[model samples]
Every structure is written in C-alpha cells, then in structure tokens.
Target chain A: MDAVLSIRDLAVEFKTDTGLTRALVDVGFDVPRGEVTAIVGESGSGKSVTANCIMRLIQPPGRIVAGTIEFAPERALSSEGQAPRAPRLRAPPFDIVSLPNRDPRLQELHGGLISMVFQEPMTALSPVYTVGNQVAEAILCHRDVSRRQAWRESAEMLERVGLDDIERRMRMYPFEFSGGMRQRVVIAMALVCHPEVLICDEPTTALDVTIQAEILTLIKDLQRDLGNSVIFITHDLGVVAQIADQVVVMYQGRVLEIGTVRQVLKDPVHPYTRGLLAAIPGLAPKGQPLATIGSVVGDADIETPHPLRRLADGRQVSMPQDSRG
Target chain B: MRSYLVSRVLGMVPTLAVISVIIFTVIQLPEGDIVSSTLDRLQAQGVDVTEEYVQNLRAQYNLDKPLVLQYFYWAGNFLTGDMGYSYLFSRPVNELVWERLGYTLSITVSALFFTWIVALPIGIYSAVRQYSIGDYVMTSIALVGLATPPFLLALIFMHIGFEWFGVSTGGLFSPEFEDAAWSWARFADLLAHLWLPMIIVGMGSAAFTMRILRANLLDELNKPYVVTARAKGVPPAKLVLKYPVRIAINPFISNIGLMLPGLVSGEALVSLVMGLPTIGPLLLQSLLNQDMFLAGSLLMWLAILTVVGILLSDLLLAWVDPRIRFE
Candidate 1:
C-alpha cells in the first residue's frame, strides 16, 4: 500500500537519424516500501529505460517525453516508525522527471536516497581505483564524513556484502575480483549510504547459476536486514519467483501485467503473460518438445491503446481491445 | 615491481647486443671503412698516396683485420666507453658525441615538455566539448599543425624572426653568443632562439598526441564505468577527469617509448635547417662520410635510448594503471 516510487504515464523516446523511436510508452508502476519489485521483460523491453528514467540518467537522443516519477523518500526512510537516520533529506515527494539533470536536490538523492547496482559488474566499476577507494568515494559523495571514517564504513560495508578479508580486498582493484566478488563489491558501493531505494538492473544475469543463486540470496537477505525497497529488473522468471514480492511484466516498452507474485504467476489474464509462463522450460514435460509461444503481440497490437482491466484478485492486466470486446 | 624492473633492465642487454650486431653489419655493409674515405679526401686535396703511409694507416686503425674481428674490436671498445676515433671530425668520437648530446637533450626534453603542456589541456577540452565550436577550432589548428613539416615551419619562423623581430633565429644563440662563455645574457639569447626550433619540432608531435588523446578520451567517455560514475552523482568535471581521462592517458604513457626516438629523429631536419649543434646533424654527417666508429656509436646510442625509453614507459604505464601492474 505504501509506495516509495510511484511512476505514472512514463514515456521515453530515442531520436535516431531514421526518426524518433519509442523506448517506453504509457509505462507506470509503483515500487512499494521495504519490498522487492521485480520487473520482468525480454531484452529491449524498456526495463533498463525505466530504471534509467527513475535515476534521470538517460543520455543524449533518449529523453523522457512525459512522466511523473514521484519519489517520497521521507515515507521510505521513516517507514520503520523510528526517527529517520542522519543524511536524511526531509522534503515532500518530488517529481524526479521534472528535476533538472544537475539539480542539487536530485544529485543529493542520487547514491544517497536512490542508488543503482548496474548490470555488468565487470565494467560498472572503475578499474584504476582500489575497491576501498571506490566504495569510500560513494560514501564521501553523499555523506560529509571524514576520509578515514568513510574507509572504515566502506570496510564494514564490504564485510556486510559477504566479502572476506575486507582490509586486503579493499586495497585490490576491481579486476582482481571474480565476477561474483565484483558484484558483491558493487552491491557494497550501492548500499554504502543505506539508500532508501536500490535499483538492481539485472545484477545476477551475468553470473553462473550457483553465483546467481548466492547473489540473489545475498540481495534478499540484505533487503530483509536493511529494510529498503528494491526494484529488481530481470528477465529470469526463476529469479523473480525466488526473490520478488511483486511482479511487473513488461513487453514492447509497456507494462502488460502488474500484480503480487502469486496473482500474476498463477492467475495471469493477458495472453502475452500466459504465453510467457508457458515458455518457461521447467514447466514443460521432460523429454517432450519445449512449448514455444507464437507471435501473439504485434506492432499494431502495441500501438493500439488497451485499457488495463483490474481482475477480482487485484491483478491488473491489459487485454487487447478485440479480445476484450 | 623490483623484479620487473630488474628483468626489464636485464632484457635490454640481449636486445642491445642483437641491435649492435645489426648496426655494425649495416654500417659495414656500405663500401669501405672510415680510412678509405679519409684517404680519398687526402688524395682529392693533392696529397701523394704512399704505400708505406697507407700500410701504417691500415695497421694503426686495424683496417686489415677480418670483419668479425673488426666488429669485436669496435664493440669491445664501445662497451668500455672508448667510442673509437672519428676520421671525418679528426677527433675522438666520444668528444664529438658528448658535445652535441647536451644541446640535443636540452632541445628534445624541453620540446617534450612543451608538447605535453600544449597538447594535454587542448586534448581534454576537445574531448569533453566534442563537437562544440572550441573543439572544432582546436581540431582544425591541430590538423594544420599535423600537416605542416617541421623544416618548413622552421624556415617560416626564421623569416619571421629576421623580418618582423629584426633578429636572426637560425641557431641556438645569437652571433655574439655563438662561442661565448655561458652567462645570463647568453642563456637569455639561447632561450629566445630556442622557442623557434622547439615549436617547429614539437608542433607535429603535439598535434598527434592531442588527436590521440582526444580520440582515446572519446572512447573512454562512453564506457560503462564513465556512465557508472555519472550515475553515482559525480560532478561533470571531476567525473570526466577522475574516470575517463585517467584511462585515456594510458596510451600517452605507452607512447613515451616511441615518442623519444621520434622526437630525436624528427628534430633532425629542423636542426639541419636551423643549424643548431645537436646530434641529428652530426649523425647525418657521420653517416654520409662513412665515419664508421662515429656513425656506429651514434646509432648504438640511439638504440640504447630507445630501449631505455621503452623500459621507462613500461614502468610508468605499470605505475599509472594497476591492471598493467598486476599483469
């Protein structure tokens, strides 16, 4: 019920030499407080675009055409019914989309109130700097702590992220770490300031199955411990089932279905959503041919407006107009 | 790090040895040694060619020895700092080389500094601004600098100095200070004339380095790490400098090895045109007159400098980038 980020009618467009192409259109979702909201989609499904829009990090030629990404940090930060911690920015909910790129308020919110864990842990970190230096830099960016204090805090954060020998590991470069270890360091960097909302953009997609499972567990455990909202963008249904409290299925830059994990996974209404569930490899009978979804949604289907119909179970599914009629 | 340094220094020995063999063979490949060229000059000057005198000259200079033995004698003496005699200059090769080396080093070193100082900021600006008017203008100027040869630029500066400043800038010193003792005034005169050749020799390299840096920085600017830094709310200036620029500067550091030899040889034409007393022209003269020891020693020194420069650059590269260091 309590939403930390309420994005409404978000639209983003990329200007290519060919013409303007829609990256996202009429996309809206709420990331509730102190819960994992997994956004599932195939590649090019605007999952990353939504994440970038939330952070206001869309580069040139890709601009948010319309949206209100309302971030109420006060609600997210104080939801535990205790006094808010230090480094808290006490402000009313503000539209992140409307804020200028260099607005001091928006910058303060970045890496402090709303931080991101990028997809590629290998390249997401600077190679030249030591892990300790980078993590401390994140702390120093948001909080007015002494350099020594920041290093100490960074060491503790690294320890918290399941890294062994924090002292020695901190001095090592990112390239020195394994993929899973680098992802852990990245998580430490993201959560160093104890941000209210952590946007993880496919954090485990690059790791092996075992490491992926470990990282997912680590994230879930940390989320439970830290009590911060997490927007987990992933295409793996298994991962969404394992970690997500709520689910948002996106296709062609549009949110087709949004509901609680059980509601959407067990009782999905949209044909596209049903096709996605059927395409899961595990659900197919062993030794039989894996059932594949035919092309059920087309360009015309996306272009046509399909109003979201709320089912009795509180799941919202957008059905094609012809099927609904 | 210490082992790396030691191994690198030790590695240069075999490289220099192979190079020395090549240099000796190549220099010998040209017909006749320094003695014949000296005798030809003498004969051209109407000096009578006597058999006894010729035999004495051959025995004294070891001209009659086998080529392998000749190579050993020269190489053996070279290792002991006995750079053999210069038949053309009629002086010890060491004296002639050492004299010019000081001036050569001063010009090359200062020009290197000049190139870095002029190129780095402009390169950073061009990359950061990318397509802005300032970037376009800087790029145009850099292209022009790249296109113009150093000798022509030297000639242009000479004419400008003579016509506009009412001062001749053909050498490293004014006429009065040409052979004078070192003094504040002589140094001042040297400084005034120095800029012309420095700019002439440095322009092409500075333009090249700037374009390299700009392109490297442009590539780094789009990397995921740069975007990560930006997403971390790093301010634009600090983000650019601390992240992308640091990585972009690796190529420049790696280029130090190539740059040293390039600047030394590149200064040759400019030095010839300007008539500055540097090794370029000296090397040129020794090579032309078949002065074996002098030419061979100069080439050897150039090889040594190249090896040392590469070693220094590798060390600096490792120091600047931890990835290279750990590897």
Candidate 2:
C-alpha cells in the first residue's frame, strides 16, 4: 500500500450568481504507486473536479476551499527503474495545495513531474501547429534538450504511441489525423516528459466505442511500461473493471465507497454503489427491464457529515443511518 | 501552392470583368452624360444650345455608340493603360489617377500600419485582462472611437493642430510645399502633415479591429487547446501569444481584403473634410459631375483593388492557417 499521491478532506467551492456553492466536500482518495485509481461517477459528481484538484488546474471562480494533496514518489530509484541521478537532488514530499499558482516549483511539476490528458482529443492539440512542433514544445519546456533532439524524441514517442509513419505524421496537423489517431498524439504529448503521475480526465469519453477500447489499452500499456501512478477519471464501470486496480465511487461530490476493484465491485457496501452496479445493462437478466434504485440520494443530506465506516473486508463505505438496510 | 495561386489569379479575371461591367452600367444608370452637363453649364451662360452641337459633342466622345459597344471600347482602352480623357480635370484620366495615387497610397498604407500596430497589443491586453480596470478603460475608448465619424474626427484633429500644436490645418503639406517639388524639406513637411490624417483615419478602424480581436481572443482563450498548452507548463504570456493569439489573428488577416477598398474610398469624407490631395475627393467630384470616363475609370480601379485585396487575403489566410491551406 505505497501511496504515491494522497488527497485528504479536499473541498472545492465555486462562485455562482446566487452565492458560493460547494463542488467537492470532504473527498479523500489515495493513488497507490504504479497502479490505476479510477474515480467513477456520473456527470457533475466531482470526479473530474477531484482530478483537476490534484493537477492544481481549478480555474477562476472555483477555488479549493480546503485540501492537501501530498505527492511523495520514491527517491532511491526513478519510476523507469533507472539509477537516480546524483547531481540533481530529489525534492521531498510537499503539499501541492500550499504552492502558489505562479511558483516555479509548481510550474516545473506540471508536465515535468505530473501531466494530464483531457477528454476531447479533437481540440486537445493546437490546430495551427504541427504534431511534431507541439510534442517537441512539451519536451523543450521540461527538459534541457535542443530543438533537433526534442524533435527526434518526439518522433520516437509518436511511433511508440502506435502511430504509423512517424515521419509523415510529425509534419501533419491535428485536424489531419482521425479522432483515434489524434488521441494517440495527445497521449504521446502527456507521456513525453515521463511524469511520475498522469491524470487522464475521460481520455476515451469522446472516441468511438472501438477507439475507446484501443485508447484504454494504449494508456494501460503506457502506464505498465512507464511504471507510473495513474488517476483515471471515467463514468463507465466497464472501463473501470477493465483498467482500474482501485475504485472510488463518488455521488454528488461525496465519496460513497473506496476499496480495491475486487472488494468494491463484488461487495459494494454503499447503496449508491449497489444502485450503480445494478444499472449496468450487461449485468441485467435476459429480456428483463433494467432494475432501478427506488431511493433518491438527497442533495440536502450532503451538507451534513456522514463518516465513512470500515468494513470487515477492508472496504470503506459512508452508510447514512436512514438509508442503511 | 503555386497552382492554387495561378488558379486564384485566373479566377479574378472573370470576376473583375463582371465587376467592370457593373461599374460601367451603374455609372451610366445615373441621368445625363458628360456632354449634357457641359451643355447645361454653357446654356446657363446664355449660349445657344444647337442640336448639331449636341450631336458633334456626342460623336467626339463616342457617346453615340451602343451601350455594349461602349463597354468594349472602354474595357479595351482600360486594359491597354489608356484610361480615356477627363473632361472635368481637362487632362488624361491616367495622369490624374497616377499623380494622386502616390499621395493616396502613402496616406492609406501608413494609416493601415498605424491601425494594426496600435490595435493588436491593446486588443490582446483588453481580452486577457477582460474586466480589469484597464480593459474597461480601453473598451470605453474603443467604443468612443467606433461611434465618432472619421470626418468629424478629422475636423477635431485639425482644430487641435491649430489650437494646441500651432501646426497648419488640412492637406499633406504646408502651404510652402503645396506645389513645390519633392525636396527633403518638402518631404519633412509632408511627414509632419501626414500624422494628423493617419491618426484621425486610423483611429476608427483601429478601434473596430481591436474590439474584433478582443472578442475573438476571448473565445479562443477558453478553448481546450489553450488549456492543453497551459497544462504543458507553458508560461502564461507565451501560452497566450503562441496558441490563442495565433488562431485569433486569422480573422484579422482575413479583414485585409475588405480593408483595402475601405481605406481607399472610405477616406473620401475625411479627405474632403481635411482637404488632402487623395483620389477620394477626385472620385467623389467625378461621380457628382457625371464625368463618364473619369468616374468610370475610378470606379473600375476600386473594383480592381477590391478583387486583388480579396485574393491577397485568401492567400495569406492559407499561409496562416493550415486548415484553410489544405482545403
């Protein structure tokens, strides 16, 4: 249970015309080293917000009200199993929440130690620049490499992402590539610097179903090769089952369940988790109408605290007394 | 790219031909050719208006020809650089147009550079700092510049030149250099007089382009690609200039075509108000007096400028944006 990144009691508030409204409240999770942690919930359930919080990319009008995201990667050996460099000392674990937005360390951490892949691949890359120029730009930003060297590395990374004809593809723009191919370029850009943590915010949500599976496989393969921690945000439970090692089920900005994939999927303690698992189309009985959860998760109840209780099987569940069986 | 350019240039021939026909027809659509206007002036002085004199005037000017034949004669002459005679200016149309073209282009080209140079950075600032006090102030000034007519601004500039700067009002030269040859001193005088018109003419267009760029940059700032660049640890300034500003400038580049014709003819009112020696005033006076060859040639020149400007802009747009280039 070597956690690479730990977020504790993270809360986010967004300013609206009415007043301030909470987007995330008392959410906590751990991304274990070299493993995938899936944040699964419906839209507006703060799944992406939690991922954004970890990346420190919460835009204006939404501020982190309370939180501490502690990132502590191992210092002895790099994630790629290479010998640690003796010249540049490794930085100690620090709270990302406390670093100012303009701090050099925070800027260095972005795309250097932690990187992100956004949802829409169609618009993730600039239209005016070539794929090689963009990927090389990322490398140039983080590393002390010459433009020619960066371009060469970019070509190799593009080939590594399963793109054919790396030389021709490097000269092409994002619009020239298909959606799936564009997603591969985006993944190459995110992984070019070999960051210790990669935050994928619905990386396959906008792709075709088959392309989605391919992208998922590409990400999983890249993660395994890089041996880095991944915070995978997705709404599809099937994707969770296929790729995630740990699952954190969130409902309306509140974490209702958190455990290993086997523990949470086979034995979901929270009623919302059970409801979600029951709603899966493939898991339903043949020719029968999909089962619907009768009880509604009240928005008002989120304000009052409901402490998470640990179960015998080592899964954590927030069981509000009124909804408990 | 070479083939595209050749095809685009070839495409302009038919377009210009069609536009030339429209310009000739529209000029003729107004009642009374140049002969009638001359006759009316002579008649006002109590000269006998004979039918033979009218026929002779018509015959001399080729006014008796059919409309289609007249178009062929004018079009043929125009293509060969023989722009016919201007009855109003009492000189060849080409001489009148060419002499004024140097002055007209100097004013318009400098004004265009002034507009872009002043507008671009301010536009980027206003958009990036959206509701900040500086943005609000710039936006307010831009609105004022947009609302105020160029002619009125020219007058105000003249007044300020007279009252505060003690500089002579109107024209691109002082009274001493009005008819003098292009000596260094006369050129210096021209440069001094040039700023007033450039600032006055460019202010309105600069305001318009700035607001457009601001709106465009605002839209581009929120796009996913911008966020992607920011996530790549690109500093805020470089991120903005490299990603969003580059895309936002496409509209600004596309505007070059429309701005060419506008800078030429749109200077008419301001030229008249300022009494500058540009083609705008000549074009206006020619159209008013129904001087057929003069007005026709001038209108034809405007049409040519517009078509050529559009071609230039399309080519530049392709160079700036890869999406349009391949398409």
The list of candidate 1 runs beyond 4 A from truth reads A75-90, A283-288, A295-303, A309-313, A320-325, B325-327
lDDT of 2 by residue, B1-327 (tens): 998989899999999999999989988998889898999899999999999999998988889999899999999999999999999988999989986777777887788899999999999999999999999999999999999999999888888878999976798888888889989999899898888788888888899999999999999998999888888888888999999999999987888888987777658788999999988999999988888899988888778877887888888999989998632
Which 10 residues in a row give candidate 1 chain B its minimum summed lDDT?
B227-236
Which tens-of-lDDT digit does each residue in B226-307 have in candidate 1? 8777777677888889999999989889888889888998898899998999999999999998988899999999899889
Q: What is the DockQ score, from 0 to 1, of model 2?
A: 0.72
- In lDDT terms, how accurate is model 1? 0.87
Q: Over 4 Å off in model 2, which ranges?
A: A73-90, A283-287, A295-304, A311-313, A320-325, B43-56, B325-327
lDDT of each: 0.87, 0.86
Docking class of 2: medium
Report the lDDT tens digits of candidate 1 across residue range A216-284.
Answer: 999999999999999999998989999999999998888898999988788776777777887887755
Evaluate residue B199 in candidate 1 and report its C-alpha lDDT on the 0 to 100 scale.
84
Put down candidate 2 lDDT per residue, A130-196, tens digits, no spaces.
9999999998887667999999999988888999889888999999999999989988998898888
Scoring only chain A, what TM-score does candidate 2 earn? Answer: 0.90
* Candidate 2, pairs of clashing residues: none
